[model samples]
Target: MKSLFLAILLLTLYGCDNSQNQSKPPVKSENKEQLISPYFGFLNQQKDSLIALPMDQAMESPEKYNYVIIENQVSPLGFIQNKSDNKESNGRQTAQNFANSEGSLFTIKNEIKSGDFGMLVNQAFLSQYKIEPFTKVERETTPEVKEKLEKKYKRKISKSTTVAVLKDQAEFNLTVFENQQDSALAVFSYIKEDQLINLDFPATYDDISTWRVDDGGQFDNEAFQVLTVLRSEAGISFVSIFWGAEGYELNFYQPKKDKFTSAAQAYGYSSPL
Candidate 1:
């Protein structure tokens, strides 16, 4: 049933005819700045990082953490299908519809880090085009394992660690919000010393008119090539989650508010560390 639904969705979004895999006109890049205008205030220009919005605070006011809308604006959800020919506007309304397609008006990314960290891999895919012969990682939280981790890292275990794995990539699932309906699926969380890194991606949609993707984990699924933490010599810190090879999204943390925020396609970020 899911396969059938996805197929129908692809047809509706793309077209009934594939034209033998014919390509469509490229989306306009001239308006990229305009499309991303809404997200200007949320970014941290001085640090070249997305504001590290606190998950707890964001949950306190979910409406303020509309990261998905920014994502939709920057990438334009339907841009992946690329069936439009506006050239000038590049399916602005369609992109907005795509943003709200699955009851998610917008989404937010949260970062949760702790020194004693682990992952649990439910499923993994090779890539978006080729998904087969996947890998599965079982969950384990035994005392002996914890002891081994403590001995290896030389740090006390704060919480049980579950290490999640992605095929030729890295991603994890952590739950920060008590209510599953209101919570975002945490992609990665780890602790290093006093630093507790928690990355959350929330799918908050406003409209469900377009085709919906059932899985909430779609954002982190093959969304990036590498995900790792980076700290500047000046004590400034951020996480660089890179897509493809060079493109990256910077997740930053603010101490005063005790929160987190992110920015896509950061300018100063040259290499992913």
Candidate 2:
């Protein structure tokens, strides 16, 4: 009887160990590569040239394109690479020059020369990457909802500010700070079924010095503007543009499992003066 009791106790302990191991979450692999959506790309126009703002790893063969162009209402025009030096600065300068120019709209050319750089775009390269447009619904806040948000966020809601709701059901509330500065910052809040799920900027500068230098104390004037919404293979994404005194920044926000997060961002056009 003593030996049988000891055996049963050992088996019970082993079963408990197996159950604990099964209940614990699996270890995530460190070697896994981050996934990027194929539909992700920035749109900007310069004169007759449709520019795709340079984004990191935005293309499979980013080496081949000196420029990325968009024609008509298409999402991605194509990839163009400057064969001269294959330098990013050259590409940016080429884009900036086109952006600064003024001209009528035109179609994408296989090859074009802007400033000192000559770029070639492969029309077939981005054929697989396509995005569908998302609807932007403008909504007004009710008195009760406004008061609830103001009290919860500890910031006064702006009556004049517009609330934009994307097709994915994410809401953006642009609120003005009540301090003397009265900075016009966006309170990115999302409501699902009339319940606030998330509230915060899609992205923010980590360093105060970076914010000061990049924004140039233009917080009061800067506001979030919806550039476009895209539906890609990865999921739905919203692109927003913020123009400060120093330059303009584009932020891509996408829905994750439960909340929206910043996927990528690109800076463009600081005053040469």
CA lDDT scores, all candidates in order = 0.30, 0.46
Best by lDDT: 2
Clashing pairs in 2: 65-80, 65-81, 66-80, 66-81, 66-82, 67-80
Over 4 Å off in model 1, which ranges? 1-179, 205-228, 234-260, 263-273
Q: CA lDDT of 128 in candidate 1? A: 10
Please give the TM-score that candidate 1 achieves against the real structure: 0.25
Cα lDDT for residue 205, candidate 1 = 34
In order of appearance, the predictions have TM-scores of: 0.25, 0.50
Give the alpha carbon lDDT tens digit for every residue of 141-250 in model 1.
35554554445444454344344443433323232222244333323343333333445444453232111133333333343322222223322223233333332343
lDDT of 2 by residue, 1-273 (tens): 999999999999999999999999999977533333322232233333444445454435543343332221332233444223233343332344454432221234444322211112333423423434435444565566677667776776554233566555555555443432423334555454565533254224333322334543334323456654545565455566666545566665676754567766666555554
Model 1: how far residue 19 lies from native, Å? 87
Error of 2 at 107 (Å): 8.2
Candidate that scores best on TM-score: 2
